[model samples]
Target chain A: MSDVFLGITNGVLYGLIALSLVIVWRSTSILNFAQGAMAMFAAYLGMTMSSHGLNFWACFAIALAAGFALGGLTERVLVRPLYKRPEINSIVVMVGFLGLLESAAAAIWSTAPRTLESPFSQIYFEHHSTTISLSPFALFQIISALVIMTAVGAIFRYTNLGLQLRAAALAPEVARLLGVRVNRLLTFGWMLSSAAGVVAAVVISSSGSIGLSPTIMDGFFVYGFIAAAIGGLESPVGAVVAGLLIGLVQQFLQDYAPSGISSFAPVIILVVALMIRPQGLFSTTKARRV
Target chain B: MISIANLSVSFGAVHALTNVSFDAAKGKITAILGANGAGKTTLLRTITGLEEAASGEISLEGTSLLNMRTEDIARAGVGHVPEGRGVIAEFTVLENLRLGSLAAKVNFQDGLAEQFELFPVLGERRSQHAATLSGGERQMLAMARALIAKPSVLLLDEPSLGLAPLVTAEMMATISQLCEKQSLTVLLVEQNAKSALKVAHDAVVLHLGNVVAAASAQEVASDERLRQYYLGLVDQ
Candidate 1:
């Protein structure tokens, strides 16, 4: 029973990371392999600020803004050149970015993982006989994920800017004809998704000691990618739901199955989910040509 | 006024347009009639700055359009309704209209009420996404989008393609009225010879990327031999 709760919580975190993946994929049709690294980088920035005894809220704000800036800059600089290239080329560029950012963080911040403590650990919830202390990290992770989902959904449904952003993704030539200022929109997309990644990183980093160490983020990247693929790469709601399911699966597997095998549940589910619904859980049957 | 000289585009071995040359005078509808793959669409694309011409000079209103960007070309009074209408599907008809208005320097938001009179169907569907629009409605929205841009020259490629005869005729009438009302210079590319000729003031016939004939619309329409021989259609 505890395992179920644990898995569900972890899955929510994974869902946030998955959300980042889906956001990038939907906008540019490029799977950003570096999204995890982007998250870790922002977390590293927060760690630096936090180590100086900065307040949690301030660190969070700084780290998140940095996320947006880094993402926007990356889109405008490193990734913009490959925009006209094929999807494979963009994917390769993302891989390169992953390597470069990870290595850069290591060179500057060292291979050591940093301790990122949360302020909300004081809160507690008793479930039956077991007591679940709602750690600051978990509270932030769940709330932040929900917030990201709502904000993104609202923008999509209610705002002209959101509609324009989506139109550029679904039909770029048409968007251009409408004079959408395509370049600005691309930067905006990167910033929005990258900011989401930063929020995920901040929440996740608080759970464990993570350093400027790139490998500290490697596991979450794997899990996030798996969650995203399982949920369907294109749908935001699909990714979140898939993330929660993955979380539940992981917890149950860890509790019941051998500890070693449980670690690989996400991968197994990833393969099965992809095989069953290649388009995604949420994607409709209608094939979109553009 | 629009002029293209020495316009050519090639996809490796196959040449799409080989130094295609033509002129569409101000306040006139110049129709280009050619079979599929005859570089008709390519010509329109070249004009719209979608394709880079191998070497050419495109001048409009005494200004060189050479090496101009597509958006800039659009801003500079050239409106292109590409083969598929190029309507942003996720945007509502009103949003789509506003977007087109945003393309030009002159804001058309104030003219929305008046413009609705021109495309009442779009007015009725002001809040619906363009994706849900029917084939004819989609074509009308596309045309309305360009018209709202208030362009000096309207470049339409295969506007009547994939539309029913009645719908096509309605589109033709809308375009004719637009040309008359706006005194708009239009470059229309169509394989449908009869209707294209009916609406055009001048016609440029192309066969395999070369201009086979260029004359007044009345002269070309009256030439039964030319219609049957060059255009591949008999007048009703």
Candidate 2:
């Protein structure tokens, strides 16, 4: 039962990470592998403030803001020139960014990893023989994902700015002629996508998940990628659903064989998903008109 | 009125247009007819800022178009309906139309009812995704979308390409009537010389990226040489 709860909670975290991937991917068509690194940078920045005696909430707010800036800058600078090329080139650039970001992080902060405290450590809930921990930081993770996803959907569907961004991604030349100010829209997409990353990182880090080098972010990145791929890259709802399912699978795998290699769950799910339907489990099969 | 003087452009090594000069009179449908790769689309796009004019001056009603960005040019009033129906396929017909209006920020003029009235079939499928529409319906949507922009001059590139014969005639007639109704200047580019010549007040015959013949639509339509070249056996 505890394992069930653990699987469910962990699934929720991975689901959030997948949602972040979807947010950026749909808008820019760039598979932002560096997204995890950007999140780590924000987390480290947040940690710096927390160590200086700031409250958890303050650190979180700072991290979210930094995420927005980082995303906007990367999109405007690093990714802008690659817009007309095949999307694979963008992915390669993201890998380069991952390396650059990691090195920069190392230069700023020593290579030593540090574990932070969960804000809700003092609070605990128990039912019968099972122990359930509802950490405030973890709650932020679930809630932040929900809120950001809703907001992103709302902006894209209802706002003029969102329409412009959609236009720029789908038909950039048309958007430019329609006065969309496409460059600005691209920058904004990066900002929004990165902001989600920051929130995800803060939530994950707040749960005392930092100090686990590469493991902290890389695990979540792999889970998110699998979730997004399985869910259908074209649909945001599909991404979230896949993320949750993968998270649940990973959670239960840990529960049944507590000593098993937990990292294999996502890979297994990924293989099964690709072999079954490479277009994604939930993607709509659109016919070619011309 | 739009004027292009000494306009020249090259794609790497190939010169597409060299010193092409012409004026599309205001409130007139000036049809530019040519064979494929004659640079008709290139000329329209260059005037509208879609393609850069390498060395030239473009002026709309005596206002300089140089040094302005494409978006700025669009905002200033030049709507282009490119080949293959430039409608955002995933968007609904209504949404596509709304985006057209937002291009220039016109407060309010023609609404959905007007669009439906102009193209009844489009009105019927206003809520449907534009991708689901027939080729002809998409053409109507494209024209109507550009019309809503209230552009002083409309740049239409192959509006009837890939459409059925009956649908093409219907679109041509509708486009002709819309031009008269709106009193809008139009720069039309088409390889379908017959339909283009039928509605045009002025015609420019382009050969090898140069304007070989410039005359009234009637004059160009009646010319024996151009008739033999474009109209062929169909010329009466």
Candidate 3:
């Protein structure tokens, strides 16, 4: 029961990161390998703000804004010039960007890990003289993830901007022919994606067990990517569900199985998912007409 | 009106279009007929700013269209339905229509109503993905997408490429009706010279990237040597 609660909490965090990845991937068709590093940078921004005596909410807002600016600048400066180039060029560039962001963070803040204080109490809630595994901070994480996911989903589904974003992604030439400013939308997509990543990073760093470091998000990114793949890279709903499933699996394995074996959950599940459903579990198969 | 003067395009050593020139008069259908590599598609693409002109003037009314971005050209009221209809297969009919309306900044409800009246099949399948639409229906949707913006000029590339003979005739009829009703300056590229000439007010025939003939559609259609050599319309 405790494992279930823990899994749900961790799953939502992973889902947030996966959601960020999905937003950028769907809009631009580029898997940003630098997403984790960007999130780390944003988390550091929040930590720095908190150090300066800013409130938790203010720091969170500033981190998201910073993420938005960083994402837009990256798209304009780095990605735009390589749009007509080969796919491998963008992939290699993102990988290079990941390294650059990590090094920049390390140079500015040092390589040492720093603890992030959670706004809510991390102590377990007591019920009938027995302490449950759930904490106020954990509850906050779950609610925040759900709210953000719902809002993002609504934005993509309901708004005119969302319709244009999907069109720009699916058929840019067609979108441009219709007068959509696809280049601007691509930059905006990156902004939304990075903001989502900042949310994931801040929440995860606020966990008692985790600390803010340049490399801390590396493991989360791997898990988030696996969730994105399993859920179908094109489906946001799939990403959250898959993230939760992965969290549950990891929690169960950690509690019951041999300690070392739990670390291999992502790899084993990813291989199994690929073998079973390479197109993703949630993706609808359609014969695309060119 | 859309005007093209001394338009030239090149890819490395291959000249796709060289000194091609024509004017598609307002409220008229100007059929650009040629063989597969006759640069018909390239002309439309260049006019829409998809391909940069090496040296030429392309203008909508009196404004130069060269050196402008594709989206800017679109916003400037040059609607192009490129080869393959250029519809997003993943989107539903309504969603595709809504995307088209975004550029015009028109009220979506009004645009949707107008397009539905024009292409009734799209209204019927408004919720179905465009991938499921038949070839003829997809062509109509593409036309509606361009029309939703209410552009002054429309550039259509091979709208009748894959339709049946009956469907092709119907599509051509619709294009003719649209040009007359909306006073649209239409530059239509087609491989089907016979059908294109039937509805076109004027014709510009291209052979190997050069305009071989520019005359009334009737004169071009009636010419024996031009039909035999360029149009592939060997007499029965």
Candidate 4:
């Protein structure tokens, strides 16, 4: 039961990152291998601000703004010219960007792991003289993830701006013929994606057990990508659901399975999910060309 | 009115269009007829700024369109329905119509009502995804999407492709009616010469990237050499 609660909390963090990846993928048809690194860099910026005597929320706000700026700049400077080029060109560039961000972070912050305490209490709540595994920080993570997901879903589903974004993503040339400004929308999509990534990174680093380092988000990114694939890269709701499922599965395996089996959980689940449903567990349509 | 003068386009060593010149008057249908590789599609694409012309002039109501972006050209009131319908298959009919209304200055509700009145079937299937619509419905939806913007000029490329003859005739009738009622400047590109000549007031025949004949629709239809060679309208 405690494991279930813990898994749900951690699962929301994974879902948040997966949502970010889906945003970028749906808009640009490019898998941002640098997404984790971007989040890490933003969190490092927040940590530095915290060290300078700023409050946690203030630092978080500044970090999110930095992430948004970085994302827009990246799209304009690096990804814009690669549009209509071969798919591999963008992929290679993103992989190169991942290395660049990591190296830059290490050079500036040094190799030592740093800690940033959550604003909320990390200690579990007690009920009837028994400690429940769910902490205030964990609850905050779940709530924040839900809020971000709802906001993003509303933007894509209800608004005129959302319609144009979806149209630009689905048929850019057609959208342009109808007078949609596709280039601007692409940049906006990247900004939103990176902001979501910042949320995930900050939440994960705030967990008491984890230490923040330049590559701290790399493992979470792997799991989030698997969650995105399981959810069908096109659907934000799917990503959240799959992220929760992965969290539950990993928790159960760690508690019940033999020694080293938990480490292979993500890969095993990914293979099984792909084998069962190649289009995606949540996807209604057939696999897209991209 | 839309005009193209001395327009030429090239891909590497191959010339897609060469000195192609024509004028499509307002309130009339001008059919650009040819067989495969006749530059019919290229000419329309260049006007909409999807394809660049090497050296030429394309103007819409006296405003130069040669250097504008595709979206800018659309905002300038040139609505182009490209080959393959270009409807977003994932979007619902209403959503597709709403996307078109983005560029329109008229009241959105009124524009939507007008579209529904013009194409009644679209209203019936407003909630359905475009992918589920039949060949005829998709074509109508594509045209209605362009019309919702109230574009002064409409460029249609291969609207009859893969459609049955009856549906093609019906589409042509609708287009002719729209042009008459709205006084739209229309450039209709088609490989189906027989059907195009039915609605066209003027016609231009292209063969090997050059205009072979330019005259009234009746004259082009009557010319035996153009009918047999350029349009493939006669049995050789």
Candidate 5:
């Protein structure tokens, strides 16, 4: 029961990361390899502030703001110029950005791993006899991720700005004809996506499962990427569902599979998913009109 | 009023529009008649600021639109229905209409009944995906989406592209009615010269990226030489 609860909480964090990937992919049609690195940089910046006696909440907010700025700047400076060029150009640039970000983070903060502090306690809720594995901190993480995801969904579905974002993603030229400031909307997508990355990073760090280091999100990135791919890369809701399923399978592997081979489980699942439905589980099978 | 003076647009070495200038009068349908590759679409795109002019001036209500972005031009009261309808196929009819209102920042707090009144079939299929809409229905939806913005200047490209002859006539009639009722300034680009000349007050005929003729619709419609040479109109 404890393992299952922990798995679900962890999966929610992975879902958040996958959601970030989906956001950028749907808008720019580019897989942002530097997203995890950007999140790491933001988390480290928040840690630096917290070390300087700032409260956890303030540091968290600052981290999100830093992530937003980093995302917007990256899109404007690194991505925008290469937008009209081949897809390979953007992919190469993002991979290069990932390397630069990781190196810069290591230079600023030592390569040594550190634990991120949590606002909530890690002790389990005391219910007579049955011990639930979910700590207060874990519960808070799950709730926060769910709430944020719901809010993001609402923004994309209900708001006027959301309408512009969707239009910009699907048909930028058409959106432009309709008076949508497409460039601005694309920048907003990056900002929102980076902020989501910050939430996932903070969640993972607080749980002490991965700890904080420049390379901490490397594994998470792989898992999140696979989840996004399985979710059809375009649907945020699909990404989250895939993330949760991946989390469950991962937990089972950790419990039942050998220690050395458990890490390969995600790859196996990804292969299977690709073979079964390459377009993704959530993607609509749209017929080619032309 | 929209004015273009000495406008020229080139793609690489290929000039799409060369030294073209024309006026679409206030509250009038000005049709652009030409065959394929005649720069009809290019002319409309240039007016909407989607295509940058190499050397010319486009002024709407006396304000220069040469350096403005597409969105800014749209806000300046220009609504464009691009070639192929340009409807976001994934979006529902209602959502597409909402996107139109968002363009000009016009609030339809009173529901989209006004759009429904304009295109009754769109109202019935408001919740359905635009992909499911017939070609004629999609065209009407595209027009409604643009008109919902209440734009003073509307640019339509190939509105009669794939519709049945009867449907094309009905659509053209609706466009004419809108021009009279709302006093819309319309720039209609069409390959169907016969249908266009029937509703348009003025006509600009293009051939090989050049404005070959600019006259009142009736004059171009009556001139057998001009009609046959540029408009593909053979005397009936």
Candidate 6:
């Protein structure tokens, strides 16, 4: 029972990360390999600011702003120049960025993992003589994820800016003909995605004493990639739902299945899910070619 | 007037367009007829700044458009309805129309009323995704999307492709009507020379990458050898 609740909370965090990847992929068709690195970098920035006795929310906000700046800068400096080249070139560039950013984080913050305590209490509740996994911080993480989901949903579904972003992502040539500043929109996509990654990092770290390291987000990045893939890489809502399902499956396997077998659940599920529904679990239409 | 002088474009070892030059007079429809690989689409692409010219120049009202970006060209009052309609299938018709108005730098609200007036069917299905639209509806949406920008020069590429004869005639009529009403300088690229010549005031025929014939639409329509040999038009 506790494992199920744990899975849900953990899944929400994974979904947040998956949403970030989906945001970038939907916009540029490039799986952002540096997403986790960018999130970790921003998390370290928040850690540094908080270490100086800054307000927790203020530091978090600052970290998100930093993520936005970094994402925009990376797009303009690294991604934009390579855009005209073959798609493989952009993939290589992103992989290079991933290595550079991880190394940079290590060089700056050292190889040692530092403590990153959540603002909320980590104490679990007791109900019916059973230990439940719903901690104050865990609940906070779930609510935060929900809020982010709702906000993102509204932005994409209702706003004019969202419409422009969709058009730009789906048909850049057509969008350009319609006077959409596609270059700016692409940059904006990266900025929003990185900011989402920052939120996921902060929330995920706050759930427990998962000490921060240069590669602290490696696991999250992997799960997020799997989650995004399950969603078919085009649907935002699909990514979140898939992330939650993956978490539940992972938790069930860990609690009941053999320890060794549990590790392969995500891969097995990914393969099966892809084979069955390549478009995604929630995808209503096949992705339109630009 | 939109003028192309000695315009040439090459892709590595291949020249897509070679010294092709013509003028699309203001308030007139200039149909560009060609066979496949005749550089009809390439010419429109170059004028819209989608393709870079290796040599020569393009200017609208004496303003040189060389080295200008596509957005800049669009901002300079050039609207392009690319081949395949380029209607964003994911977006609704209203959103597509809104996107076009973005290039015009005007609020779409004012233009939306006018667009709905021009194509009443579009109004009925404005909220529907472009993918759901039929071939004819998509073409109308493409034209409406381009026209909403209120461009001084409209570059239309193969608007009649894949549409039925009646739809093609209606589309051409709408285009000619728009040109007459707006005094729009138009470069209409089409493989349907018969339908195209019916609405065009002037015509340029291309063979390979070079202009093979340039004359009035009637003159080009009347030349049996040129029409038969180049345009694939069989005289009745």
Top candidate on DockQ is 3
Candidate 4 per-residue lDDT over residues A1-290, each given as its tens digit = 89999889878888988999988987887889999999889888887898889888988898899889989999999999999999899999999999999999999998777777778998999999999999888889899999998898788888888888889888999999999989999999999999999998888767778867888888889889999988888788999999898888888888999977866797788889878988778876677554
Candidate 1 chain A lowest-lDDT run of ten: A281-290
Query: What's the true lDDT of residue A247 in model 2?
Result: 68
Writing each residue's lDDT as its tens digit, candidate 3 over A81-134 gives 888898899989999999998999999999988867778999999999988889
Candidates ranked by lDDT, best first? 4, 3, 5, 6, 1, 2
User: Largest lDDT belongs to which candidate?
Assistant: 4
The C-alpha RMSD in Å for every predicted model, in order, reads 3.6, 2.7, 1.8, 1.5, 1.9, 2.6
lDDT of 6 at B148: 84
The regions of model 4 sitting more than 4 angstroms off are: none
Q: Model 2, residue B62: what's the lDDT?
A: 94
lDDT of 4 by residue, B107-179 (tens): 7789889999999999999999999999889999999999999999999999999999999999999999999
State the lDDT of candidate 2 residue by residue for B1-236, as single tens digits. 98878888778877788788888888889999888878888888787677777898889999988777777888888878888878998788887887877867764345556777888898889889988998999999988787777888888899889988788888878877877888788989988898888889999887767777888999998898987775342543
Tell me the tens digit of each residue's lDDT in model 6 across A1-290: 78888898878877888898888876766778899999989888887887788876887888899999999998899988876688888878888888898899999989788756667887898889887888888888889888887777677778777777877787887787767788998999999889989988777555456767889888888888888888877778877888888788889888889887756687788889877877766665674232
Q: What share of the true interface contacts does candidate 4 keep?
A: 0.80
Q: Write the per-residue lDDT of candidate 1 for residues A122-156, one digit (tens) a residue.
A: 34567696777355556666777888877876775
Using lDDT as the yardstick, the better of models 3 and 5 is: 3
Listed in order, the DockQ scores are 0.37, 0.65, 0.81, 0.80, 0.77, 0.62
Clashing pairs in 4: none
Q: Which stretches of candidate 5 lie over 4 Å from their true place?
A: A285-290, B109-111
Model 2, range A1-290, lDDT digits (tens) per residue? 54554555676666666767776766776788988889888888877888899887788788888998999899888899998887778888999888888888888886777554556653445669555755455555666677776787678778777677777777888777666677888888888878777766776666654552433687788888888888776566777778778767776766676666567867888889877887778765352111
TM-score of each: 0.85, 0.93, 0.97, 0.97, 0.96, 0.92
- What are the per-residue Cα lDDT tens digits for candidate 3 across B47-93? 88788889989888889999889999999998999999988888899
Query: What TM-score is obtained for chain B in each of the predicted models?
Result: 0.95, 0.94, 0.98, 0.98, 0.98, 0.98
Model 2 vs truth, CA RMSD:
2.7
Model 3 chain B scores worst on lDDT over the 10 consecutive residues at: B44-53
**Backbone clash numbers for all candidates listed:** 5, 2, 0, 0, 0, 0
Tell me the lDDT of model 3 at A44: 90
Q: What's the fnat for candidate 2, on a 0 to 1 scale?
A: 0.65
